[model samples]
Target: MNDKENDSLPVSALQHFIFCPRQCTLIHIEQEWSENVLTARGRLEHDRADSGYREFRRGKRQISGLYIQSEKLKIHGRIDVLELEEINPKGQSNLPSFHLKGTWRVYPVEFKHGQPKENDCDRVQLCAQVLCIEEMLGVEIKQASLFYRRIRRREDVLINQELKDLTRNAIKNLHALFQNRTTPPPINDKRCRACSLKDICMPKRMSVKSVKYRQSLFQPQEPL
Candidate 1:
């Protein structure tokens, strides 16, 4: 895909692609969506996060529902919570806005509906947010955090090379999928049960049809 197409893609697509390519395609390419329990809960969680509030605490400034974009990464989206910590400007360069006279380090915090999962989906999403912040602010973000409602705690994520690579690759893959505008077949794993698109996907029925098609490829032909 070209740069224009890539820039048009949403940052959320990375998380969806990590969770399931088919799910990503279903939502982005096919433009299909259904609100199941899990999805509804997630929506509620984001709604709370995107309340558009700003708070000041000690040496830090907390801004919620801030929109960010990165031309380098070709992604744009709204950040859940961005914390800017005041720092002494020893020899640091000035940022674009004079309001931020003192050097401020940015830290992104993403909110989740459930506990930490045994996957890199959430981590990748957080890293993508950091990338956007870095590009926009002209600074390097070394770490971020994820706040899970279930655990009521924050999980710090390091914005390292591995995660950066994974996120970039996922974005490229998703852009390619979007350019082609094709939906991938489902794998019908346990994750499918919780997916909002399960009904529309019909993984089990599709899997059966796929099996039958494969079997028919080798079936003996009837005598004429």
Candidate 2:
């Protein structure tokens, strides 16, 4: 893919990848969505997070939320939360948010369900957000964070080169998924038990098939 296609990635892609590649492809590529209790609860949480815009000051740090987008980044999405340095206090009202002073300073926060996982999925999403911010503000963001609803605490994240690579790779994967237009077979694991797509993915059935295939592979080919 050309640079144009690579950069055409969406910030939400990172989240979908984290949740499940198949689910991500289904939602983004197929434009399909069905809400279960888990999705409903997540939507509610985000709804509460998006309801208002608040910027407060505490010891020289300014906290703001619900920042919509602008001409920068060229991608449309809302950031969960951002911490900006205190500058240009009551300054220019006409200045675009991306041009606001402390433009080089930013902290992106993403809210998630359950606790942290043993994967880089969430970090990848946060890194994508940082990329958006960097492109929009014409600055570099080196770090971000995620807040799990279940944990009710923040885990610091770094948008280092590794994460940047993951973000780029993830975008490529998402593009390939869209091009293929295929839903992946279910991944039967403990994680599947909590996934809302259990009914649709039929992970248990897929797992059984996998087991049977492996068994057959191991079975002796004596008659050959």
Note the residue pairs that clash in candidate 1. Answer: none
How do the residues 82-111 of candidate 2 rate in per-residue lDDT, one tens digit apiece? 776544566543225644543235677888
Give each model a TM-score.
Answer: 0.87, 0.74
Q: Write the per-residue lDDT of candidate 1 for residues 1-224, one digit (tens) a residue.
A: 77565557688988998898889988877889999877788888898579998998876889899988878767888999998887865536445552666677788999998899888999988888888888877789898999998779999998899999998887778778877875677879998978989999888887856967866888998979
Candidate 1 regions off by >4 Å? 1-7, 89-94, 208-224
Q: What C-alpha lDDT do the candidate models reach, one value each?
A: 0.84, 0.68
Candidate 1 TM-score versus the reference: 0.87
Q: Which ten residues in a row have the lowest lDDT in candidate 1?
A: 89-98
Best by TM-score: 1
